[model samples]
Target chain A: MILIGEDLNVMSGEISRVIKEREPGPIQQCVAAQTKNGMDYLDVNVGPVKKDPEGTMEWLINTVQEVTDLPLCLDTTNPLAMEAGLKFCKSKALLNSASGATESMETMLPLAAKYSADVVLSVINDAGLPSDADERAASIMESAAVANELGIANENIWVDPVLLPIGVDQRQVTSYLEFIQMLQDLLPGAKSTCGLSNLSYGAPKELKSLLNRTFLVMIGRYGQHSAIVSGFDRELIRLIRGEVPEMVELIYRAMDEENMDISALPQKELEYVKTVQVLMGKSLYSHSWLEV
Target chain B: MMKYEPPLEKISVNIRETVVGHGEKALKIGGENTLPFHFFEGSLPNPPGLALEILDTEPENWAPSVLEPFEDVVSDPVKWAKKCVEVFGAEMLCLRLLSADPMGKNGSAEEAAEITKIVADAVDVPLIVWGTDMEEKDAQVLTQVARACSGKNLLLAPLVKGNYEEIAKAAMEHGHAIVAQASMDANLTKELNIALCKFFPPEKIVIDPTASALGYGLEYTFSIIEEIKQFGLADKDKMMQMPILCDFGGDCWRTKEAKENREQGILWEAITGITFILAGANLLILRHPEALKLIKEMVV
Candidate 1:
């Protein structure tokens, strides 16, 4: 999987402070550490740190290039800031991101074409996040059509199904997995990504790690090619280090604590789910493995 | 309809270009930006090379098919090495120190070094000095050969998990390249490379993922080579970025099919060599002269 390092983003208070202070030490350190941890690309998001988002983005790109040569994922809400980073990048950057939103398409597509950069286009427009899988697939296809017309090659596109916080709407989890599978059918060669941490927004720290790693592996079977994630997260790292585990112990733990339903799993996997249910004395409660 | 372009991986890690036998005799390999022969997508900077195999001592119990070709020079290492390059048009020559095996002649390290030096001096092309499959004897023999041909830059072999540190140190202390070997496991191949890189540079290493014959796990060998290439091209895995050397001829000639029929023997070797080439092997160490000729013609 192509892993984009997410630690450099200004989402954290410490990183925001470092960017605000114009300290190259922390940012460069983060880039080195993440690259060592096996990040294919580093996501650089100078999020609202200063009046000049473009200048700050440029500084971030330049500072990062000084330390290492790994490709940068130029991330920003502002298209101009993204372009500013792209313009200064020594190598091609993965543009993160565009959406079905007209303004995003109008700005990001031209930059992607002009720079010959790969782009991440989310499957959400002014119509807002799709409530179902088909709606999400349609939004992604529409955005891809625009990108295709703009001459951005299909291989250079990453389609994100816009993962929602499961805590807010539990139903979005099923839709997210389904949409990832639908992405390949809709946009043949286009890659798919997920910001894995979004799945556990309201969950506790340990539970959040479990949720993100398990969900990443599940979506992987559905054609998700990459994930924007913390490489240092042991659970996420463990998955990338080798093939997915035959069974994730976290699933049994979640059922034990949160009483989460796992019937969404296919037949073969459901057998294990049923075993866990029986072992936990939950549904179709039966004798434990130790009993007989 | 738009042409369905496969997503060619943007290779981030470069396979270090290695030059063997410095100056006029130097042959370059690696530095490919794409999978082997996917010239439409990216460049294959160098053509896969062929190293004709020659043994240091005569074969008393050799396969009749292979033994027939070198029947005249079977007794002499220097003459056998010369016949490969001067007569057969071999791009490189590999001198296998078979007599150094503890179970065989139990030849001293000094004797192996002497013959290696003789082969090195005789060949205008580069030389690959391979050790016996025996571990402890290989360490002793290869250490002597590395020191004897110190600056000749001969490609030494059989750097397994057991003798890696010893031979790796010798290759580094002397100026020779080492072939890191593993048995059909891509991860183990990378692990050996990574481990060797701690002492010897990655550029100075060639991966030998233990070649398999045509009827004997060739598909498994193909997948391992493809995985090594994909990791380099797709994930830019630095440890997997080195050129691969498949010693398929050794395994191909030893199969029961080869022992039964001479025609089947040549076909087995040819198909195994071609399969590995397509699967991204940069060097093929071959036995049959006809298979070598066929591959040279096919690849060009």
Candidate 2:
């Protein structure tokens, strides 16, 4: 898995303070940590920089570039900020997102083409988030067509099916998995990524890590290309990097519904089995599913 | 005249840059994000490394032409290694422990390690310690070599499915890189790499999908190499992202056509080397110095 470091996002208290105060120390430290932790890219998310968007993005890009050379994912709603960040990037940058919504497609796709940068196409439209896998595919294809017409190659368009919290709607989790399974056929040559932590948003802090790691393995089994992931998650990184093949294999076997005695599994393996069942909607979503 | 624009997609990840040996003379291979020699589209930070092959014992069946260049030093592995690096201008040397073959001399692991130490100490360039394909013997000999040459950062070859665990563990414990050899099948190559990466770091692993000689399954080897590169760069499969190594000199020299004439032998090796280079080989091991010179001049 190609890990885009999510630790530098403006949503975090320290990261937001560093971006707002223009402090290079914290940003560079974060970059070093991510680089050492084996991140392929680092996300520079200055959320919707409403005030001095251009200046904030330019400062953030320059500060981060000073420390590491890993490509930055320019993540923000503001197109002006996105362009500013793209201009200063020493390497190819990923435009965090555009959607099927006209305003987003019109503003973001052209910048992606002009700059020759990869752009993430979120599967949402003016009607808002898609209700099912088919709806999500329609949104991605419509936006991808616009991107292709504007000269962005299909390979550069990373489609995000918009992972929602399983606790809120268990069926949508299945829809996202179905969409990923259909991604290669639906939009040939395009890549896929997701904000992985979004799937655990409503879960308890103690359970978020398990949720994120389990879903990552599930999506990876379906050929999800990459994911925005926490840089500090060593076990998660290990699992994705093929360091823990037995664990990944167990998850795959569970996903395949291979005949196995659940009683024979160890405690950790049983948790994974249960997590896979919940994610696959074989069992009901509950806060205590692992306990059950 | 028509203006032509090249169609290119920016590769997201580079094949990891791996440094072998130590110091200023250390060799760096891989790190190119684009396909081999596609300089118009992407950067090739390091050119492919070239290593000349040397045998731990007197070579038994080497053709006359291949042996002519190193006739004086053939009996002495250390002297032969020095000749390749100092005289032929080889940037790297691969010491093949053929003496350790169970059917051959069946050289002891301690003896193999002693010889490896002498050659590794003699050559300033990076050294690769290769073993006979007998997995049990290779595991024993290579582990000893890895221990004796600790911190030399030597590249070990032919870590196939049968003995990858023992050898890879020793390589990691001793701080060395490994060449994970698979048959001429892309899926097997990937499976071996994935298995190796479970314990070893991916940066220290190189893929050898088993090169075949020209006119003898060369196309199969070529297709497999191309497929591995495409899966690595286009599909971005991490398991297939290691630099590829093609040790085709032995296969090439053993061919009937190569033995027919000296010039044909040189051309045979040169053609095989360059073919794999074009198909995305990051490290090549060739026997004839002239063929190495010809390939370097042609591709570099």
* Candidate 2 deviant stretches above 4 angstroms: A1-292, B1-6
Give per-residue CA lDDT, model 1, range B73-158, as digits (tens): 98998888888888888888888998888998999999999989988988789988899988899999999998998888889998
Please write out the lDDT profile of model 2 over residues A119-238, one tens digit for every residue: 999999999999999999888888888888999988999998999888777779999999999999988889999999888887768888888998999899888999999999998898
Error of 1 at A103 (Å): 60
Task: Name the regions of candidate 1 deviating beyond 4 angstroms.
Answer: A1-292, B1-12
Error of 2 at B215 (Å): 1.6
Each candidate's DockQ: 0.01, 0.01
Candidate 2 residue pairs that clash: none
Q: Write the residue-wise lDDT of candidate 1 on A75-129 in tens digits.
A: 7877768778888999888998988999889988899999999999898898888
The TM-score of candidate 2 is 0.53
Q: Give TM per candidate.
A: 0.53, 0.53
